[model samples]
Target: MIPKYNLVLCTLLALALAACQTPWVRDAQPRAGDAAPAVAEHPTATPEPETKTTPPTPAAPEARIEPAPPPDLWTRLRAGFTLPTRLDDRRVQLHLQWFKRHPHYLSRVVERAEPYLPWILDRIEQAGVPTEIALLPIVESGFNPFAYSHGRAAGLWQFIPATGRRFGLEQNWWYDGRRDWVAATDAALAYLQANHARFDGDWLLSLAAYNAGEGNVLKAQRRNRARNRATDFWSLDLPRETEKYVPKLLALREVFTHPADYGLELPPLDPDQRLELVETGGQLDLALAAELAGLPLETLYRLNPGFNRWATPPDGPHRLVLPHGASARFSQALAELPEAQRVQWQRHRVAAGDTLIGLASQYHTTVALLQEVNQLRDHRIRQGDHLLIPTARESLERYSLSAGQRKLALQNRKRAGNRQVHVVRAGDSFWDLARRYKVGVRELAGWNSMAPTDTLRVGQKLVVWTQTPAAANPNIALQRVRYRVRQGDSLARISQRFKVSIRDLEQWNDLDRRRYLQPGQVLTLYVDVTRQAGNG
Candidate 1:
């Protein structure tokens, strides 16, 4: 109803007032679900700009980690060395000085011990003994498994026959467990631990006992206790060998602990580089084992010196040590091979005079074994019966490291003096033989590769090294000759033909009087040419 210009100006003023109230009403309004506020809202008010909400970022996953490998064998050994390394004692100093003077001695010993030290260290750790005990082999045998002492101690642990037997080490024609490093190590460690317990945790006394026997150590302790003296290892009146033995071990600990101080460069032995013990399943030929392991025969022999023949024992030990890489191959090959094919067999036809005893002797087997193989109820066998005999795959001579071969090599070795072969008689003794040969008993035994304590058989042959030749001696003019046995030949006939006694014939040829000689068997005879001339 107002004029046009006046109406437009009034309408603009109203619109501006409405716009100013709109924001106030919208801000004053209650949020959704909140209690209502006392405020009036403009119906056409613009809504607030829609707010954008961002999602949280996911957390990163943790990184994976790996554990480090174990340290080298020497480092592990050093870490576990719990023995007293102080060298204040004069005895320990003396040994230390000697070791320092011979630096190469440790070098050679370490070289020999490389293949065995890791295992030795592991055993010592498991037994909860001082790691220094790992070095005992160096003191005992310079790590030589084949070492045999004049005192009848043998192998790396230097166990005498009696001690070895007591420790369950079997000694037989086929095997000597004393020379087995693995078995000997376990036995030696067990022995040391037993002595340790016996000596009231005195490691020094325990080590002394290991060298000089527990009885000797106990006897020394008893004497000391009676005297009201200290029963310590240093205070005891031990044997000269044992007195130095404990100190020697301590000195070794010092050298090994601080090799740089002694100017010794220890050999690097990887902790992972090790030998693995594998089950052989049963008796196996050494040659076949070597072939299966992809190793040389000599190498196999070196690793397993316990075997004395071309094959393992007929009885069971049923285990072998092989290189870590070769163990799997050997085990797989052995498993694939048939049991019957393990050993070579021969079919023997029983003749009229063929007794099990005679056949066993001829085939170098036992009567019990012959009976078992032939499935005989007893030793009785009928003529024309076939028997399966186990024989060596290779010639006996091929096994050069065998006991017999070693003896033959020793007998044939050239020496400084004239070699004389002596044929033993029924009443012969080492003392009597040494006196007759004008040689020291030790010298006579050494020439024949025998110990003085070894028993002598009536037909056993001994080698004597004399300064004078037998031919030059007027009392006995002897000549060495080889005689081949013919069919139907007897020791009596050979003795009669050679103008030698029957006892002399058996002794020269290493024969049994009860057994008949095989045809074409060679016999070594030392003929008395002077007696022959007299008979002529």
Candidate 2:
């Protein structure tokens, strides 16, 4: 369809053409009312019926229009790839062989990369960088936006907290911008570009610096200089991970650039049909946003993985990514919604005897959910204070899992949610039970109405909640303090002094009440200091 301005321009052009096609008569100078050159008017043509009985069919229009084909993201990525034709080609082949041995790994990573690969390629193209850079996430995070490593690297780029913040990605209680596709991509590319320049345009060295820090790369380079050795990426002594990191990216690029050669199929995707960004002016619950957009909450979370909770941050940078074709519907629906109604909200003034648990119980939510939504570090709330409460979605399982998540979740899920009772056997400690059941010690204690430090009796039936982790109470310190029995100290006197029960002391020390106390006899007393007075 023609745009309005274009349609108007077309109309003007047609009118100009019609004016050009007008029949004209030559002007003649009239001496005295000489017969003014009369312009000949063309008469409309009417075809006379022929003697033949058959009538002719009408001709087709002068112009035939067909809809343009949608741009294919995979095709663009293939074309835009920074093809390796030098020594790196051998490295790429090496990676290809490694991939051939472990083909499923590549397939899984590719499946995970499907959502963001197109967008990453587009960003690389826009930045005029080597499209090979697009494959970096495969090595760093497998393109899993929620991917976090034990090394503390996170998101698709696998940026650690310091590096993430260095690139201006937000890290906070409610949100982490490292998981934000848009912000993280921009920051990552900017860092890549800056480092690429820092290493004097050697992308290999730059990539190494990205994997290891610039300081490490510089140290490697300095060592090479001192040894009078070649300063190429291969020659430098770098971290084991960084050494293979750049090669992995290049190898992945080769496979992606020629998927068929590697016996792999690149997933098909439309550039315009990929995920789209929607601006949220303020805090909006993802559950409500999903409902309005007709999306599963899991899908919303996948698209907006930066959100650490059920909703966006109370502060700004409020945005949500929606699947393609849903943005318009969501935007329209959102426009119609009053700001107050965007997410289900309840405003309650803190009354006497109000606690986070009590308020959460009254509102049908969890203390953790309330704390997360309101950025509360503790359950403490004052009287006459107002609290914004968010209604929680029943479960995260209601939403679909991303390709990577499904695999990991399936593996871990095998041990979770069995809901079986464990009859305590002799020598079974809470830690032992927790390790056996793959549950937390504190959770085991909570389920069985005990404590992590509590002694377990033989043949006791313990209820286990496998699906949930023990919610840690940061304010409560479960510490075992050493106490020595004085000459006058009795079990009751020791218990009174430490605010611990005599029964607990007997269990902890494995002593009978009949045993006499001796001077300087050491005993372990588990005390929750926070529950006592004069504690912070």
On TM-score, the candidate that comes out on top is: 1
- Model 2 lDDT tens row, 218-300: 99999999999999887898988887787778777767777777778766665566788888888887778888899877778
Per-residue lDDT of 1-536 in model 1, one digit per residue for the tens?
A: 65787667666665765564554555654555678656554444444457945344334334456879778778888788776555799999999999889998898889988888888888888998988899889899999877777677878998889999999999887788898889999999889999999999988889999999999999998999999999988899999999888888889988988898777898777645589899887778888888899988877777887888778888857788888988999989998999997888899998654567657757766777777777888766767889998877788777777666677788889888888777655567878877877888887776676777877864457777888787765534555667677888898888898777887676554467787777766676766666666432
Query: Any runs in candidate 1 off by more than 4 Å, and if so which?
Result: 1-66, 348-368, 375-387, 472-536
Q: What is the lDDT of residue 44 in candidate 2?
A: 28
> In candidate 2, which residue pairs clash?
none
How high is the lDDT of residue 411 in model 2?
Answer: 36
Task: Give the poorly placed runs of model 2, Cα more than 4 Å off.
Answer: 1-71, 83-93, 347-388, 393-412, 415-536
lDDT of residue 134 for candidate 1: 93
